[model samples]
Target: MLYQSFSGDAEVGTSIFTMNGGSLTAAIGPLFYITNTDSIIELKDADLTAMSGTLLTASADRWGNNGSNGGVVTLKAENETLDGSITCDSISSVTVMLQNSTVLEGSMNAENTAGSMA
Candidate 1:
């Protein structure tokens, strides 16, 4: 993937990664390093009955596409907890919905956007 980044430096791509449970051992580097526009990332809290220690963690930064055009991120957490970070460049969009008294740790950084967790 590193080689592709140096090809043109004009096009920004999108990749999706999802996890349902358990651990991901021996992982190197950031799982999601988004720096593109028109990307979609959805992190919803599913399976609330089990109630494990920690469910998910994420980090993304989409700021390379068109200088300030980031992708879209939809996070829906219901009856669970989520941690990590999400960052968007200028003119990006993100919708975060926490239901059933859910908890979201870590941070979400979005420029020129408004959101509330209640």
Candidate 2:
């Protein structure tokens, strides 16, 4: 299933939509109001559940400066059954490893925080 919209309006089949010299490439579905001054979108392995709106700009890549939002960025699984919770800009670092691993259950609102485990 590519996309089955209830009302949000995205159902793209025979998927090859590209706009070079300005940059846009979509295969699957669901992209609305991508008001691009400079844009890049890539999805390799995806089964992402949900995300609601309100991001009024400033999301530069190269692993730097990930801030400004109205809350909701989620990546559910990485390297098998990874659980979640990551709230940046308030400053947070959480890393969980194998064999019955859990971290930062609740109430860690950071001004400056650091954590390490192996």
List the candidate 1 regions with Cα displacement exceeding 4 Å.
Answer: 1-18, 24-31, 37-40, 44-65, 110-118
Model 1 clashing-pair count: 0
Clashing pairs in 2: none
Cand. 2 Cα-lDDT: 0.24
**Candidate 2, 67-91: lDDT as tens digits:** 3211112211222221122222222
- Give per-residue CA lDDT, model 1, range 1-118, as digits (tens): 1111323755545544444544342244433333333343443444322123222222223334343433444555556565444444444455567777777665665232322211
**RMSD to truth, every model:** 7.3, 15.1
User: For all candidates, what are the clash counts?
Assistant: 0, 0
